[model samples]
Target: MKAAEIRSKTVDQLNDDLASLKKEQFNLRFQKATGQLEKTARVKQVRKDIARIKTIAAEKSAGKKA
Candidate 1:
């Protein structure tokens, strides 16, 4: 998802998305450990996406506080 798309979502929605992404990240790591991962690039992608969601979420929260 793009930053713009993430920004459009409410904080609750962002939190939900973050939770699901984290779960996926965990599953991806498990797959890698088991040597069953097909697309290794997915690990990197999920990491970046989690970071993106976090960055945007923080920005939103800070904006609200300020």
Candidate 2:
């Protein structure tokens, strides 16, 4: 998913998306360990997406605190 799309989501939606991405990341790791992962690039993409979501979430929280 694009950062713009992710940023448009509400915090609750972002949390849900983050959770699902984490789950997918876990499964991808196992697949990689077993040499079954066809789309290795997906792992990198997911990691970046997770980071983006966390960053956005932190920004949102900080905005609220301010």
Best by TM-score: 1
Error of 1 at 25 (Å): 0.4
* lDDT, model 2: 0.95
Candidate 2 local lDDT, 6-56, one digit each (tens) = 879899999999999999999999999999999999999999999999999
Cα error, candidate 1, residue 44 (Å): 0.6
Pairs that clash in candidate 2? none
lDDT tens digits, residues 1-66, model 1? Answer: 888899899999999999999999999999999999999998999899899999999999999999
Candidate 1 residues lying further than 4 Å off, grouped into runs, are none
TM-score of each: 0.96, 0.95
Q: How many backbone clashes does candidate 2 have?
A: 0
Model 1, residue 8: C-alpha shift (Å): 0.7
